[model samples]
Target: MRLRAITGFFFVIVMLGSVLLGNVVFTLFYLALSVFCLHEFNGLVKQGTADPNLYTGLLNGIFVFLAFAAQSYFPSKFLLFLLPVLLGSIFIQELYKKSEHPFNNIAYCFLGLLFTITPFTFFHGMAFISGSFNFHIPLSFLLMLWANDTGAYVVGSQLGRVKLFPRHSPKKTWEGFIGGILITAGVAVILSRYYTEYDWKQWVSVGILISTFGTMGDLIESMFKRSINVKDSGGILPGHGGLLDRFDGLLLAAPIVYAYLYFITNA
Candidate 1:
């Protein structure tokens, strides 16, 4: 528990500090993390396999960085052009390599990078938006996820009698799941009053959805880990596991919440 808390604190401090610095700094940090995460992800895929020497991990890292930079700086048309170009390039490369499972590793690596980095584009977008509200959007994103996770832990520990999904995650319970939503919604209302222009009703709605779906994201990653018969994604952090283990919920929650913010708000 102490180790987890320490690691969590370090993550929060570094993340908030980078965001406060500016978009460019934040983008650089995110780009570096995206590469690291993609490497870890591909390593997982290639472990104990015949295709361990594949360069799909390196290529996927490059693709993620390029995609993020394009999405942030270039026009949508450029993005459209880049996609097919990248796909054809990867396909041709795989064909030339001709491993036993030539396409499988590359396809999965590319998809993993996409899944990991796209949502983070929203954080970069948030930092670019004009506002004098001290720019709490990034903090709010992390806070909401934290509230949901912590609330689920405390509440579930106290009153988790009914299993939520024993097959996916035996430790999860329906009561704890609802507890996470309520806590996240409560935090959202508070954030709405201070930083955001959103109404309490909308905040609550978004909060509940984010929390529920975030839990599902955690479960989905857990399912992947279970299928692969691994204990944790990696042991990079002290007690928090890997990037996947820590940010599993955000993989799903970030995109959903970003879409809600984009469509629901006039900003």
Candidate 2:
């Protein structure tokens, strides 16, 4: 428990510091994080004989993230075109390997990109919403996510009785779920006052989305691990398990929240 708390404290500092610094640091931080997560995902899935092309997949994932980040600086959309080529390279590279399940390898590699890379790419977009570096959106998103996780753990430990999803995650409970939403909503309200980019209602909506879908994302990752019969995604973090275990909620929430913010801002 002490080790987990120590790791979490430093993790929050690094994440928040990157955002506060500027767009470049934020983009680079998540870019590196995306690569590590892709590597971890590929490694974990490989335990089942899917044998994803980690090199090609990492290259593709890095390219995808760079393309997304480039949208902020470059006027021409030329770089985005490279994404398809990068993705295609994965399939092309698979032919040389004598793996029995070539298609399965390709599929898991694609899944690694979709499940890990794409969401972090979307998160990079949040920093440039107003044609400038705005840390509030992404920072607020992280805060609400943390609130939900913390609230769920505290409330669930004390009052949880009924299981939320016994198959994927047995420790989760309906009571904790509700507590998380309520706590996130409260935090969203407070954030709205300072980060006036969005009104209170929109922030609350984001909180709801994070608490709901973020929990789902955690469960989904848990299901992935359960399918493979592994304990943690990796031992990268001292007590947080792995990058994937720590950021699983962000994986699904980032894209959804990005879509919501994009539509509202553009509309």
Candidate 3:
């Protein structure tokens, strides 16, 4: 427990610092994070018999993220053209690399991008959600997600009786699920006071989405880990597991919440 708390504390500090420092740090930090997580993900995929194209996949991940990051910093159409070249390079390279289950390799390569790159691209796009880089939206989103996670764990450990998803994660409970939502909603209320871009109601709605989808994201990752017969994604975080384990919630939550913000902002 002490180790977990220590890890969690530094994790929170670094995450918060990355956002608060400025866009340069934010971009660098998350870009490094995306690559690290994808690397970990690749390791997980390779444990099976198929080998994913690490370099090409990493290139694609880098390109995809930089493409969006560039747009956030400065708009350009020329950067958009690089997508096909990078993505197509995966297939082209795969054609020459002789390996058993070649198609499986190709599939996992793209899956890695879909799994890591896409959502992260959307997350980076969040800073520009208001047509400029303001950390409030991204920072608020993380806070709410963390709040939900902490709330669920505390409540689940103590008051949990009924299983929420016994198939994937046995320890999860309905009481904890609701507890998370309530805690997230409370955080949203606090966020409302500072981030007036959206009122209390919208923040609360975002909280709900984070708690709901975030939990689903956790279970989905659990399902993936179980299918592979792995315990944690990696040992990067002491008590947590890996970057994947820590940010699994962001996998699903980031994209959905970004869409929600986009829709409302445009609507």
Candidate 4:
């Protein structure tokens, strides 16, 4: 328990620092995170008897992320051209290898890029919503996520009785899930006062989305681990499993929240 708390404390610091520091740190931090996440995803898929092309997949993922980050500087059509070429390379490279399930490998490689890399790219989009490097969006998103996790754990431990999803994650409870949403909503209320980009209602809505979808994200990763028959994703983070385990919620929630914010602001 002590070890987990210690690891979490430092993890929060690093995450906050990366976002608060500047655009360079934020971009580089998430870029490195996307790479590690792809690495872990490939490792897990390999355990399931599929040999994904790790190098090609990593290169593709990196390129996709860089494409998103550099879209402002480069032509928007550049990614439309670049991604197909990069994805084609995966198939071309697979021909050289002697794997029985060639298409399976290709599918997993694309899955890694879609599941991990794509969502993180949206995080960069969220930061640039104001046409600048404003840290409010990203920072508040993290805070709400943390609040949900903390609230779910605390409330679930004390009052949880019914299971949320016994198959993928038996430890989760409906009580905990509701508790998390409520707590996150409260945090959103506070965030609106300081970060005035959106109203209090909108912030609360973001919190609700993060709590609900973030739980789904966690469960989906648990499903992946269960299918692979692994306890943790990797040993990269002590007491926290791996980078995948740490950021599983962000994996799915980031893109959804970004879309919601984009539509709301534009509408």
Candidate 5:
């Protein structure tokens, strides 16, 4: 417990610092984040599964992030360039390798990119959600996510009785889920005072979405780990398990939240 707490403290510090610093730090941090996540996914898949195109996938990750990070400067057409290149390189490479399961290789490479890189690209785009670089949206989202996690941990440990999903994650409970949603929405309401662009209701809705999908994200990752017969994604963060463990919530939530915010604001 002591090691976990200590690790968590510094983890929170780095997370806060990266966002509060500026767009550059935020961009650089998440870009590196996306790359590491892809690398980790490749490693996980390679344990007995097919080998993804590590270098090719990494290159795709880097370019994908750079294109999205500079959304204003880079033409959307540049993103189109990546699709054919990714498919062509993977397909062509597999043709020569004479692997036993080339289709699986091709599939997992695509999955790795979709699983990690794509979602993170959506996540970092939150900075520019308001037609400019504003930290409020991303920062607020992070706070809600953290609040849900903390609330769930406390409530589940104290009063959890019903299993949320015993197969994928036995520790989670209905009580924890409800507690997390309530706490996250409450935090969002409080956040409305500072980020006045969105009222309490909108933020609360966003909070609910994050908690709901974030839990799903956790379950999905748990499913992935269970299928692969692993306890944690990696030991990169000590007590935190891995980057995937830390941001699993962001995986499914980012894309949904991004679409939600965009539709509401633009509509």
Candidate 6:
């Protein structure tokens, strides 16, 4: 457990630094991490009851990385490239041997892509969001997420009684989830005072989304692990299970907050 915390802390530092560096450094780091995570996720599928398709996973990872990078760098070209590539991949994969679960395999492959790579585009988007308020968006999002996770663990351990989803994730409780939200909101309120650019309302909204959707994100990953009959996603992070285990909440929270800000401002 100590080792896990140390390793996780270091990982967090490196990741946060990469984001703070905010340029090609973070982009490359993010891409590499995404590939590693996708590989780890696909490894779980392969190690279990299903026959693992290595090439499929690799291709899917590439496409997901390309899609995200293109979306961040070239929005107009992203869709133009994304649709045709998706159709082509499906068509090519379909032409191969028709297994009993051909579509099932392909679907899972794509689902892995979407779940792993799509949310990360939000981070890329954050790097480019202009305004005096934009500089702190990523840090604020990350800090709120960290607060939520820490609060849930501490509070839930002390006072968690009512189960949130006993079957899906036995340890998660309603009390813990609410505790996480309150703690995260507290942090948000404190930080909002310092942000002279974004209104307090915007920060509060981000806080709410981070805590609420963050909990949902944690549950979603739990559902996936439950479906696969596993405790942790993998043994990569010593005690934390896998990359997905670490980033699950961030994955869900980032996109939601990004979209909220985007639509609110753009619309």
Candidate 1 backbone collisions, by pair: none
lDDT of 2 by residue, 165-202 (tens): 99999999999999999999999999999999989999
lDDT of 6 by residue, 77-157 (tens): 645466566645754675575567766666667766678776776766765565322447777888889899999999999
Predicted candidate 5 versus true structure: per-residue lDDT over 11-101, tens digit per residue: 9999998889988889999999989998998899898678877888788778877877778445477776766776578788887786889
User: Each candidate: what lDDT?
Assistant: 0.73, 0.92, 0.91, 0.92, 0.88, 0.76
lDDT of 5 at 132: 73
Most TM-score-accurate candidate: 2
Give the distance in Å from residue 173's predicted Cα in candidate 3 to where it truly belongs. Answer: 1.0
In model 4, what lDDT does residue 74 have? 50
Q: lDDT at 142 for candidate 5?
A: 91
Off by over 4 Å in 6: 48-52, 74-79, 131-135
Per-prediction TM-score:
0.88, 0.98, 0.97, 0.97, 0.96, 0.88
Question: Candidate 1: deviation at residue 44, Å?
Answer: 1.0
Tens-digit lDDT string for candidate 4 (5-110): 8998899899999899999889999999999999999998999988998899999989999988886345477676778888899999989999889999999999
- Candidate 2 has what TM-score? 0.98
- Deviation from native of the Cα of residue 131 in model 6, angstroms: 8.3
Kindly provide the TM-score of model 6 when superposed on the true structure, using C-alpha atoms. 0.88
Off by over 4 Å in 5: 73-76
Regions more than 4 Å wrong, model 4: 72-75
Tens-digit lDDT track of model 3 for 1-267: 999999999999999998999888899888888988889989999887679888888888888888878988888978888788878888889889888788899898888888887878788888888898899988999999999999999999999999999999999999999999999999999999988999999999999999999999999999989988899999999998999999999999999999999999999
TM-score for predicted model 1 compared with the true structure = 0.88
Give the local distance difference test score of model 2: 0.92
- By lDDT, the better pick of 1 and 5 is 5
